[model samples]
Target: MASEANPRQGRPSMTSAMRSSSFIKEHQQYRPPSKPENHYGIDTVVEDLQASKISSPRQISPFNGVPSAENPPTIVESGVSHELSHPNCTSAPGTKYDKLVATLFYKSTSPRVSNTVHSPVRVPSPTRGQSPKPHPSDSEFPPNMSPSSSIDTFPLEPPASEPEPLDHLYGSHISPMCITSFLHLMSTFPLPPGTADLNSAHRCLKLDATHDYHPTVVELTMSPAPSLDYLSLEDLRKHELIYRFEREWNTDVVLRSDTLWRRYPRLVVFDMDSTLITQEVIDLLAATIQDPPDLGARVADITHRAMLGELEFDGAFRERVKLLKGLPASIFTELRPVLDVTNGVVPLLRALKKLGVKTAVLSGGFLPLTSWLSGELGLDYSHANEVVIDETTGRLTGEVKGRIVGKERKRELLIEIAEKEGIALEQVVAVGDGANDLLMMDAAGLGVAWNAKPRVQMEAGARLNGDSLLDLLYLFGFSDEDIQTLIA
Candidate 1:
């Protein structure tokens, strides 16, 4: 299955997977291997025959080179029942064993055919009670659609094979990695003091501050032998943190995990707009023109609906673009002043860079903003939609030229960027907020929903509801001293 982690598992590379398919094709017209003289002694063959408890092999088999009516060819034994005895059995020459072996050989010996690879129908999953679309990240697609389409939705079941930790694969015990997040009260406001009580006497958690940033980076640790199963323990702890503090602080909860970063050297990717930045670029653009002041509110509403999954993102994007038609391209520069860069963007990114980690931005927002963000923050790569402009008029055309890098495209971009840098998909960490970011998030080694919507918060691997993006630095295992030294 494509979702199988290291889909290339057992095989060496992508080429090997193709060869497996080729091998299946070649075996369609099967041929038996040439039988040679006795390899194993006749006694061995007789022993195997006797084990089957067949009174006489010839009576039911070839039966003097003719099919027997009493015991016909339809008497087939599935491999699950008993594997066919190999033809290599042999014994001493002229012995009773030799006689028995020859008698068995004279009868018909059948070979089993494997039907798994050859079956055309996909067996319905017994557990997938209600059929939901297989998430694009999972690489399961409908008959007509290709894997390239980026429709972001939750997979009925997350593909487990791709991740080692989920399978509890780290030298005998579960990985000792914990997701620690420092919460911020608002997008611009830094994490308030004492909201995250590191000294809490909770049975499932232990807190230790690793940084001196406003909210203070804290490690949310779980015991080696957690009360809950390893797979569900971290998530349960995360929910507990959110439930305890999210309402008091006015931000969405997302968890940042350093253990994952330390364990696997990865390329970290982030989504722009409401994620790395405080404001939505499209809504910001909508607010630029004051001809109808409510235009900003209208566009903002649309953006909110889209992010909340209440409206289709693609169509809503088009509608937003249409509303911004004839807007000057200079808005990009003008908006920079009003663009509220999220707290911790600089420190978090700087820490990653100092750690020799590569970073990129894959945004659903436009490239002009994304490109400028990459330049401003020193990101390694940036991918986003190109807003078509009437160059002659220097105004927006309200059209997206080329491919709109939607959810699936985000996943593809993550792969392309990682591969270009010589990293695998499992060595990538994706951060985002909106529904569209889910595909790439799910595809990444770790997906942190940073102040995301409810849908994303629930589905993402980790959630950091707090506003401070710098807490991400702490989550990646960097102490305040480490970050300051690296940036310095």
Candidate 2:
């Protein structure tokens, strides 16, 4: 009865404890074994080891699942033993146990299985001018780090590109033309090799608007400037330029103090008919005689010969006059309105006037026509052959009144004018386009061939193939604005 009472007393308390907690009842629901079995058996361990051996040439390292070299696993010592405790699997820190674990882990994790030397993984180096990237091995943020809060520690960014300069571009402001593009042009343009390189023909000089100093390229020598005129057309072909030389237009040649214009600023003498005015004056008179074909052709032939130094000018004038003996005296007036002046004539003459330079005309063409042009162009001096007329009949008398204005007369006139103006010969500039004009060209300080005959172009100091007499302003170091002011 005492034992029964004691057991019965404990039953009620046990029932109370059981009612307080239902965990033991839930545990009874699972029917698994009392002791946990090795999920990875000896067969599984042996199979894993064989697979690793067959795949990799490298010897397996022993010690948990850590590789023999780098990239060691972050093994948890507490869990590794329990996980690797099978009969055949590696569990201890001994060589045999570690080799089994190393083999298993290496086979599962390594990209390749080889004993051969492997190149280390390459990290990309930063590109030039770019900021370097942060490495993955750098200190990691704490697990509690917020991305927004980490903005203060951000890596550097690449810099932005710089803006291009605009002041040097065209239309930014109206600047002087760059003359480099025209430097190597023309028969007598001064062109020496740039630094002894053949490719140097392309090199051009840049000069300032003031025209007061050295060229950006090598300074041009006056002595070598005329060398191009001596080149045979074939030889000149060897100095072929790929393009014209100019930045827009420059004053390199004119800026050189040695240039004829810069060294001496004096007189500028011009031819009357073909040069100052754009016609052969005698041809106009011959045109009025088309009624007599023989007479007109004979006069034109004589005129051509006189210009080419083929016939004496005095003889040609008398013979051509005999052919024009019966022409109307109104011929000059009839042809006056139809005259065509060369391009840029007004601008060039205006520039010359502003400079206070003396101007003259030495012409084999008629005095009546040249004298008329002298007054119109504001000439300082004028000399040309005169035609005598029978006053009663008002017709040409087949005679010249004074000496014929041939090549010698033209040269003499240039010298006389330069002397009258108290100027030296080197201070004189003569420009013409005929064989007869060569004599005056040789006498002047600087002689330019303006759209002249081939022989005249080849012999003259410089040649202007372009029709613009405004180009003459460039030779005197005049800027576009300076020329415009002269015109205005």
Candidate 3:
């Protein structure tokens, strides 16, 4: 029956034969397997999927999962094309079994596995005719080296930069205009050729908002042109640009060395008459003469001329002393308590002594007052003219016995005291208020004129017209706390 039926079928229509052949070819090629492992082997499927053909629909992805448009995953490869789309990402639409398999494979073998999806790899494509790059293998990275596991792989914060240079501005009252003009002078006046950006970076630091002296100090930080030579305080006194500004602003403009500003002076020499004390000792002595009641007035006029640089100091001094011929030596004892000591002298000298500074009085006044002041103020040295006392009467003999402690003598004494103390002349500071003090002031490292005459103020290194001499401490870079502690 099979032969007869098959012969009939074989010789029958060509449509029947075509149907059988089509069914056998189509069904046999896609026969369903008993197990998923037999149908989809990841290792074998990956090998057949070439890097260039990764986009082919026919190939099975090693990471089998549903593709996602919202949260795409990333894969790192040394030189592989980043154009490869992760079609089998677990978030993509897929069967539960496929997603489970993908999750397991990714957790076990993926180099970067995390809860959060990462950005797609953006490796640059290879040039024309270049070979496709191989993907990075899992074995290349250590277990703890992944970005998910290690902190070292993350970018770190950068280190901080250095702070700027700081300087202190000291004055009783620092107005906005004062600061502005001062900054302008420093930036523009002393610069060398091609120097630019002077004081470009500036900040003003005010320590106390409410204090005894308003704006007594302000900390300034600025970057000056490197090539510019800062003029000394002495030169600045006469500098036309600064002099004009100072005159207009009623401020003393000085630029002291940062080194000198911080260093405490080892020796501080003070001029006597009209400086340490309020009155000239000679004028005080001359006032005691009875014969010529106008002698004191005449001597005072001459002393004023001598101090103002109108008359020679030695001659004026002798002329004044000649008028004091009959004054009883008891005048010295009488004048001791009545001498009007300038304000802040006691605290200033006390502070200086506490700092181990050797203080001295280089005076054109007679020896008695200078000696008394040195003892009273704890000064280390005293030098002054010696008046000849009459052995017969305990009175002045109308003459000076030895060398006059004039301007030249003051300068010499400052040097001698510094040298004797084993201190350098550059460590000396001279404070005075007369024309005679000019030479001595210029000779020392720092010279401060205390409410001096117009000429003296112009010639000295610095002039203090503030309320108290204690403001001098500010010039030395001592703060409120530092000065209070030192003086205390």
Assess each prediction's global lDDT (C-alpha) against the native.
Answer: 0.60, 0.57, 0.66
Whole-model lDDT for model 3 versus the true structure?
A: 0.66
Ranking by TM-score: 3, 1, 2
Q: Looking at model 3, which ten-residue stretch has the lowest summed lDDT?
A: 98-107
Regions more than 4 Å wrong, model 3: 1-172, 200-213, 219-233, 260-262
User: Of the candidates numbered 1 and 3, which has the greater lDDT value?
Assistant: 3
* Model 1 residue 428 distance off true place after TM-score fit, in angstroms: 1.6
lDDT of 1 by residue, 321-421 (tens): 98898899988887776777888788878877766889999988999888988998999999988999997999998898887777878889998888888
**Top candidate by TM-score:** 3
Can you give the lDDT of residue 143 in candidate 1?
36
| Candidate 2: 10-residue stretch with minimal lDDT | 98-107
Q: Count steric clashes of candidate 1.
A: 17
lDDT of 2 by residue, 192-291 (tens): 4431111112212223234453233222222222233445322342333311121122111222224344534679999877788777888778877867
Residue 408 displacement (Å), model 1: 1.8
List residue ranges in candidate 1 displaced over 4 A: 1-217, 220-264
